[model samples]
Target: MRIRPVGAYALLLDCDDPDHVEAWRAELCRRRDAGELSAVEIVPAARTVLLDGVPDPGRAAARIAGWTPEPVTTTAAADRVDVPIVYDGEDLPVVAGHWGVDVPEVVQRLRDTEFRVAFCGFAPGFAYLTGLPEGLAVPRLATPRSRVPAGSVALAGPYAGIYPGASPGGWLLVGRTALTLFDVHADPPARLTPGTRVRLVDA
Candidate 1:
């Protein structure tokens, strides 16, 4: 695991292989449980884990380096949220055709595999999801869209994501879900926080 101390309280660990996911997670979990790391939160993505909370970054990183944790058994614990979707995205057929699968089959695959918010980026509440079916891992459009409607379910760069708010984007849109993902008035403002679990349902 390649570790970097980010800011005052976060220890960033970058993993080179998917096989290292559990091993890296186990180390962090051990430190957190033992109170070796006073992290306010722990955020893990496809290739990285973040320990958020500490008085000093240097001290935290040193402390973490000394403790060798037991092996870890990694499980996605991603919440299986069912989001109703409309199969009317402009690129739905193109994606299905790209994978040589029918439209219904594409939708089924999307809804069947629960995805985790690998990270939130490009916009608030827009979560990059992992666990996309191998068949559905399509690339982004060559040209970006000027504005994608909110709740648009899309895929790009081996990751899936929902459009939280209108913005220019290049992801291949597979469908549109009715779920409202962002609201500025809400307590947290963004519906999809990092580490959220999600699944789509054809409606």
Candidate 2:
């Protein structure tokens, strides 16, 4: 891990992988909760974690430099959520053809795999999920739809994601879920947060 100064206040933790970023973010949160550190936000991205609202970036940098991280593991006691999906997407056959498999195989592959919310981006409540096998990674659509409906479950590159609200998208849709991913009236709006474990169950 490398700590780099971000402007005058924030520090960015450059991690090797998503696992390291998540593990390090969780560790920082632990420190913050224990009163060992104070920060306005410890934000995570695909390969980097940002410590915003830092009081002393230089001091924080020194502390993080000496800190060692434990081995990263998937079963680190995180919140698990099951999302029900209807495997009736327009791109079902497209993905299957790309994978050289039938439609049912596509559904089975998604149902059997365990996923985690790596980070949220693109739109509110839109979670970029990790844990899809590399063999199943599909490319994004050649032409993006003018508007994708909310609750659409899609895949792009190595990540799987849910469309929290109707918007334009290019990810290959594989299914649809009934769950509301984002709610302004609800506490903490987004249901999927970083490090949260998720599974797609059949609807």
Candidate 3:
């Protein structure tokens, strides 16, 4: 792990991998909620956690350096979301060919996997979910679509994602849901925040 300064009031922790990032983020969030750490935001990304709005970045960095994070376990039931999907994407056959499996097998595998939100990026309410085994990782499209409809469930590398709005994207689309991923008028705009567990079920 490496701690780098992000301005005078924030610290960016570069973790070894996504697992490390998740572990550290959880620990930091726990400490902050318990009044053991001071920070305005504990944002997590692919392999890093950003501790922003710290009053004393130097002290916080030093403290964090001495700490070790454990693997994350036990997600609260309320944090789990079931996204209903209809698996009839244009790239469904392509994905099955890549995996050397039948189309039905692809859907079954997806349904069996329990995914977790690693981060949110690309666009508003677009959560990058991780859970697919490394061996099942898929490549991005050679040609990205000019416009992907909102709620498109897609996969790229080892991450599964849902397109929150109509936009150009390179991820392999496999399914879609009717659930509103982002709503400006809602209390919490994004439905899949980091650490939330997700299950994609048949619509």
Candidate 4:
């Protein structure tokens, strides 16, 4: 593994061990919670983890090199947030048709409360949710949309997300919600955090 500086405060880790990213992430979080590291953000991605906030990037890298992080506690991440949805999206019927199931089934699946905030990115406060029902896995359109309204529940591949704000998107839009996933007035801004659980509810 190698740590490359991203800027004055952030560094990107070129992690070779693909399967251990989550383990490394948990460890980093543990260190942060214990006040062992002066890191502000330790974000894990598909193959890289971004470590940020360091007075000296080299020292931070050395600290990380000498130490290993632990996994997040199940209790701390146990609670799930219910996101109310209307289940009336433009792509709802089309998604059902592709799955060979009726729209009602799609509604039930959307209402299923067995998903988690896999990660957050692509947009501020927009979380990449995982654990979608296996049969409902779908692909993005050949052409992405010009604008996806905030709180638009969408699914593409094995991931699901609610657009925090209107923007170009590729995921199949399934529904819309009125909930605010991001708020500039809030201290942290991003309403959904990684490891946060999500339960979709029919409005």
Candidate 5:
């Protein structure tokens, strides 16, 4: 792991892997909750976590350097969320072609594989899920759509994601769920947060 100063108050922890980054983020959040660490925001990404509003960047970096990260599999059971999907997307055939499989096989693969939310970005309530098998990785669409409908389950590169709401997108759509992924009235608007386990199943 590597720690670097970001501007004046933020410190970024560059982890060896995506799992390590999540472990570090969780530890920092625990400390923050117990009044051990003063952090305004703890943002985790694909392979890094940003600690913002830190009083002493050097001291924070030192603490993190000494902290040993835990294995990623230790995620709590409460973090798991299953999303039911209907495999009737416009790009299903395209995705099958890319994977060298039939449409039914593509659906089966989604049902069998487990995925985790790596990070949330691009839009509010939009979670980028990882854990797709290497063989299933496919490139994004050559041209992005002007507007993609909400609840559009899609794939791009090594990540699988659902469009929380109508917006512009480029990822190839494979399926969609009826579950409301985002709710403005809810305490936490996003249904999928970082480290949350996600399973896509046939509706």
Candidate 6:
């Protein structure tokens, strides 16, 4: 891991991978809640975590450098969300071909996998989820759609994502859900924040 100052009061930790980032973020969040670390935000990305609004970035960096974080466990029942989905996407056959499986097998595999939110990006409440095995990774479309409808469940590389709003996207659409992923009027706008576990159920 490489730690760099982001500004006057923040530090960005570049980790080895997404799993490493998640582990560090989990530990940092635990410390913050336990009053062992002081920070306003602990934001995670594809391969990094940003510790923002720290009182002393230098000291915090030194402290973090000496600490070791364990792997994150996502077995908490409270953090799990079940999303009802209709597996009738335009790219469903394409995905099945890529996986060398039939359409029904594709749906069964998706239902069996437990996904975790790695980060949020692209648009509001759009979460980049990780959990699909590396071997089952799929490629993006050769050409992106001009407009993808909201709640489109898609897969790209090793990540599974849900389109939060109607927008242009390149990911392979495999299913769709009706759950409101983002709501400005809600207490916590995004339903799938980082570390939240997700299960896609057949609707």
RMSD of each: 3.5, 1.5, 1.0, 3.1, 1.5, 1.0
Q: Could you give candidate 3's per-residue lDDT for residues 1-203 as a string of tens digits?
A: 99999998999999988888999999999889989899999999998999999999999999898988889885887889999999998899989998999999999999999999999999999999999887888999999999999999999999999999999999999999999999999978999999899999999
Number of backbone-clashing residue pairs for each candidate, in the order shown = 0, 0, 0, 2, 0, 0
Question: What's model 3's TM-score?
Answer: 0.97
Q: Is candidate 1 or candidate 4 better by TM-score?
A: 4
Global lDDT of each candidate:
0.73, 0.89, 0.93, 0.79, 0.88, 0.93
Q: lDDT value for candidate 6?
A: 0.93
RMSD of 6: 1.0
Across 45-158, the per-residue lDDT of candidate 2 in tens digits comes to 999999999999999899888877666566544468889999899999998998899999988989998898888989999999999877878899889999999999999988
lDDT string, candidate 1, 1-203, tens digits:
67887875678888764335435666666677887677777766677877787667787777767765455333454544667888777887888887898887877778778775656768877887777655556777888999998888887877888898788999988888778787889987777765456777777
Error of 3 at 72 (Å): 1.4
For model 6, which pairs clash?
none
On residues 1-203, what C-alpha lDDT tens digit does candidate 5 reach at each position? Answer: 88999999999988877778778877888788988778799999988899999998888888778877666784666778989999898999999999999999989988888898888999999998988787788888899999999999999988999999999999999999999999999978899988789989778
Per-candidate TM equals: 0.78, 0.95, 0.97, 0.80, 0.94, 0.96
Candidate 4, residue 23: lDDT: 63
Cα TM-score of candidate 4: 0.80
Pairs of colliding residues, candidate 1: none
Model 6 over residues 1-203: C-alpha lDDT tens digits? 99999989999999999889899989999899999899999999999999999999999999999989998786688879999999998888999999999999999999999999999999999999899887989999989999999999999999999999999999999899999999999979999999899999988
Candidate 4 residue-pair clash tally: 2
In model 1, which regions exceed 4 Å deviation?
7-10, 17-35, 40-46, 66-78
In model 2, which runs have C-alpha deviations exceeding 4 angstroms?
75-78
